[model samples]
Target: MGPDDPDRPVKLAHAALHRAGEPLAFGGGVLLAPGTVLTCAHVVNQVLDRPDFAQERPGALDLLAVSFPATGRRRLRAALAAWLPARRADGSPAAEGDVEWSGDLALLRLLDDPGPAALPVGTGPCHAGRPAYAWFGSGAPSSIAAVLVQGVTERWIVLDSTGSAQPVVGGYSGSPLWDRAQRRVVGLVVSRSGLRAFAVPAADLRELFEEAGEAVPGPLGVEDGAHGPMDPVARQLLGPLRSVLTTPEALADLAGRFLAELEAEPEPGPEPATGPGDDRAGVDVGANDARADDAAAIDAGAIDAGADGSGADAGFPASAERLVRLATARPHGAPTLLALLAGAARTQEQQSWIATTALRVCPEQFLTAAEHRELLTLLADGTVPDPRRCAAEALPLGPDLEQAHWPEAVAELERYRPRYGRFPQLLRTVEFAAAAAGPGTARGLGAWSEAVAKRLGLAEILLEHRAQARESAERARERGPQRGAPAPVVQVQLWRATGTEHFSYALHAADARGRPLHRSVRDTPVPRSRLLAELGALLEEVTGQVEPGAVPVVEWFVTGEELDLAVDQWVYRPDELFPGVLGQDFLCVMRSPELRRAAFRPEHRYRWQVLRSGRLALVDRQDPVVQQRGAPVPVCGVALCCPAEEVPRLRAIALAVGVPGVLWLRPADHAIPPDRVRELVHGAAPYQLPRLVYEARLTESPDGLHRNLALVWDSPDGHPETLGLGDPRD
Candidate 1:
């Protein structure tokens, strides 16, 4: 039948049987054929030997009863009829026989009618490739699967049905076989493998009937001009014979009636297979069968009581009543009920009873927005803990919403506030608001901020406010009193003698008495040789031409800590006139002062005194009056030329001892005239040299020309005195 045929049955139409006390069970033509049944020997063998059957009932020795469609009530009836025994020829008890050991097929004769029509049998045309329909029951439904005849034997016909082309579960030992074209019984279902299915041919059944001493029924014949069977006339029949016996309208009407009856009735429970040797002596088979029919009525009453909450349905409780009833009555009711409820909720209408039943039956399937909201509220209020927990776990947010959905989500949160008054919900709301505002705008942020402020208390707020205030103060200014101040200025003075190569610059700072300050060298690349020459000339001019009776002083206001010796030392020249050491007589004055001071000590009775005018006074030893009136004598100026390196120290000492000037004496040829030296020193007057000189003395060469120069100066002097030997060869 087509899937939509209303008269088509959705359940199995055949019954199976086995020896009640043995482990043999066979199914198929037994229900249709009362006295004679066809079955595969393998089915009988399985039940006769199976351990579970033997353990359930011990004594097995006779007839077997069969039930069609093996549902719950049917199985119960079969179980109760297990005591029935098979009868012998004289109506005596018969022993159970194992049939599988015999061959591939078997036949049994019932003692009484099974209340059904005799199974039809047909003679095949023996075509090798004709298609046939096979029916089998797996204790479930009877389904027809296609098979093609591969070969024919005297008793068995082999069919090709394997892999995708395999027949539907034809392994059931007694399943029926029918001709699809004529819709009539053709053969009994039998054995199958990957390559072929084997069936008991109708001719074999005829032979078995003759062997049992029964007359074989003639095949339903066709008219002289017709090509098919005519008995029971294919156009008037239904079921496997409907295509051949019935008209389309009749079939449709019958199918519609069958469907209506099926819908009205509740599903039956499972049934057990019947076997031979069941006790039937005290059993009321008729009354038990009646109860089996009433079982469906009882199931329906249970469903009604559960639905209406009557509390009288003894088989069902409130929590599971609705689901059980719906599942029992309708195969596809669960999803339909839930869908209707969800639909109603979408339209903002009241939820119907069917919808609620669906949700109770299959809550996981009802995942609509309204249902979700309801579930959340229920969860918060603890109304439905189990379902609420399930919804929460399964329906977390996924990647399917738009940005605008967040506002709706917020509204949902507000609506459910009374239900889910937990900290997590509040926190999540605040976090969502902050994120939605994009770190810039304050939109929807007030609630979050207020929540936090309320939660954190005032102390935290005050601490944060103070921290911000301090940060503002720090950023307001770039500098402070302790940083980036100007350096102190130091006053320095320069002096030298006329015609001398020695010159001095003094730093008179109270903090730096002995050391000469150094300054930064300019970035310009003045040649080293030119710099030395200029420095030498400048030294000569400052030291050579100093004025008598006044301290030579050139004041410089220096910033920064140290001075540049190379630049500061070059500030004074030997031949330049200053109010300090001057002329050749200045050196004589410097040398003579030591000798005069030594003689005028208290131990020498103050014999003589040296004066600033280059004059020395002599004292009498015993004449007090003459010693007191000692007159000064003037000495002619004379140059004692030394190496250049000795000039800085000598000039330092001279300036320290208060000498006006001192000349740097050189060999006569090496020295220029005082006036010429003055001009050379003046030419380099702008250059400043270091105030203190560092001297490295050397032994004289064999020719008397000193290879090293020694520098002399006091700690307070402006520059060092350098003295060197003249070239001896000259």
Candidate 2:
């Protein structure tokens, strides 16, 4: 075996050490089974956070919390099952002064379901001068550390980081010691003294298990030469998905996104630092990943140098590969990933293959593909569904409800609580990998979904929407700006300092393509009523900046998950003959500086340009089939076709995967006919929406749609920050 095999990562999962807690990682341990971990007894002591050393094994797991560091912060609760304390020559308890001690091995049993891809352990000989590797924990970038075997003692192998990039330090305890030459974990790093570290060899571990009359774990098979192990049946099932892959980079990208979904969302707080043996990375002294110090991480860069030119570690993204291998081996892997992509209607043959090969796979999985697809479909182009809301409660869900009866489908839907960014953020994420799986994946999935939705109990519309959004998301420019000067507009800057949700805004008189109006008054704060009054006065003063006959568009820049701001309801002048509603009086829109901070993505510009051409889609949330009725138009803006409280957020996401103008009515008490609302907002050019609504509001019908109209008209071309949009959070 050669050092730096990309395949080494497959085995990294076996270096399961750490209690499920902060500072990630305990001392390294080799995974013996899906639920069992083996490490040093002292390392276990430290991981439990008992200041003084206790040789006795934990009596129960009630107090234990174990998690693999490479797997983010989610805890995998566990308990100590076996304990072999260090002993002196006379069989007395070993002391710190003892140069050589025996039997410092322990086994841990997981109380929680660890999912698929348990670590596969391989044995390697303990030899001096051999290269060794380890990592602090998982999920973090570049945590691998390399070292060399200095010498072998009676009970331990010594390692030195003399010529390595990083050394064995405080947090490296209990981490698996991978033998670079053998391509398998050879020992557990027991303790460290500055540059020198001590580890119990794999032989010692086997001896510990055997002396207790336990069966020694057999060696796992490694195939594909250096690319590493994969379930053969899974590999067969995914043949189509693999064939459609454009590049290894694409696969890696999907894998990264999948892993990112599992980790904690980035929050405003201090996170533990990186690097092995770093005190904060672990919970206790001598902790490898946590204070247990299970830093069995291998050097990631070493993956670049595999046997056949590809890095051995470069085979698959470690976490994703592990999950695929683990889940699909039981045959649930592919289906779980294909959450919204599965269905017999889309490809009955593919679905049937799993049944034919059911006996062939282990770690079995069951799926309700159509139903899963249905839930996702509803999410794709429509409103956000409450996880607890059931089909029995949905009106006109259509009669195609058979798939909803699929075993565990609704239960699975209820279980889907995503920590990802926003509403369609889930839709975008789930569909990305499926789209890359094969050509027509989007189309096939859409058709099956549509069939289900036609009667809808909701399948077809969702299918089509997901396909369009996903395809468009990819085609959109990742980064760029719109061409030409943005339209004449008034820019509003709403700044709320950290530690508060209340916002303070300023109105700016912006000229097209001019400098960004930067204003943040973190120190001087005002009440909501006073701020709105001041904002109203400022808006009145800035309306003069707008060219004659052009509507004054007020674009407010806000950030984070803030969605409910009554910016449109503010009264510009309460004392005047007409104290007009801000949204009704002018073109008021909300712009997320955080979302648009990168400036205008091509999608933003693409739609903005189309709106310039007067093409807009009128979509009724109640019955949106009209947009699909006629030939597809290059619509740049969308008529929200309903009141503010009524439109699905996915509609906003669908108009443009990046950014596009949206127009709707403010929350209204009375419903208007869809045709009337459409003819009113949809008939006018996208740019003329504000003026049309303004004129209509002054009509004799004071309760008309015009009085309640609201437009989120954001065009990168005429955006407030034609200068620059640098978010304060950035």
Which 10 consecutive positions of candidate 2 have the poorest summed lDDT? 291-300
**lDDT values, one for every candidate:** 0.32, 0.48
Query: Candidate 2 residues 588-635, lDDT tens each?
Result: 776653444332254454454334333666765543432231223445
Candidate that would win on lDDT: 2
Q: Residue 190 lDDT in model 2?
A: 74
lDDT (C-alpha) at residue 287 in model 2: 28
Q: 258-355, model 1: which lDDT tens digit per residue?
A: 22433445345324223433221111224433223223323333222222334232312221222223323343333432332233232221233222
Task: Give the Å shift of residue 26 in candidate 2.
Answer: 45
Q: Over 4 Å off in model 1, which ranges? A: 1-13, 18-27, 30-32, 50-63, 70-103, 110-126, 137-139, 142-144, 163-170, 211-730
